[model samples]
Target: MNDSGAVLPWLVIRQDDNGNRYRVGRYATRAEAQKMADSLDARGHKQLYWVERIGQSVQ
Candidate 1:
């Protein structure tokens, strides 16, 4: 949650190769999330997906 009462969404990255997912970190902006994903991709983790967190959302 931020200064507003609404729940803030998260930017998540998952490793597609092994069906394992990990939270790179939480961000209030999509750009921050993309940046993190790109950083991971540059590090050779190409099999990754970026997703947003929604209300009552399930992985």
Candidate 2:
């Protein structure tokens, strides 16, 4: 949950070429989003991939 109290799953993704990060989409749970991220990595959709909870700050 966030300050707004909205409940949803979220994940972070980045493009391999440009190193730009963006939100993949909302899912039912964190695990599902992580699975998607892993799938992307496995399939070579993205060279650099990451998955994290919504509202989380990445450094």
Candidate 3:
């Protein structure tokens, strides 16, 4: 499953440190997305963000 957003909903998570940490995942709800990201046990510089389709993808 791609888990890509269909409606283009999103949640943005950010980390500080050379600006090199981020992740994206599709979610039915913002709460669900936040839970999923929290479940990752992010440490050091691992930031998870639930961002929907803002632009367009070729593939």
> Per lDDT, what order, best first?
2, 1, 3
Candidate order (TM-score): 2, 1, 3
Model 2 agreement with the true structure over 1-59: per-residue lDDT tens digits:
66678777676566557766667666657788888878778885537777777677578
Q: Candidate 1: TM-score?
A: 0.60
Tens digits of per-residue lDDT, candidate 1, 1-59, equal 76776554766666677787776677777777777777777777558767576453345
Model with the higher TM-score, candidate 1 or 2 = 2
Report the number of backbone clashes for model 1.
Answer: 0
The digit string of per-residue lDDT tens for model 3 on 1-59 reads: 23553563544444435665444555556677677666654543444333333342222
Which candidate would rank higher by TM-score, 2 or 3? Answer: 2
Candidate 3 local lDDT, residue 27: 57
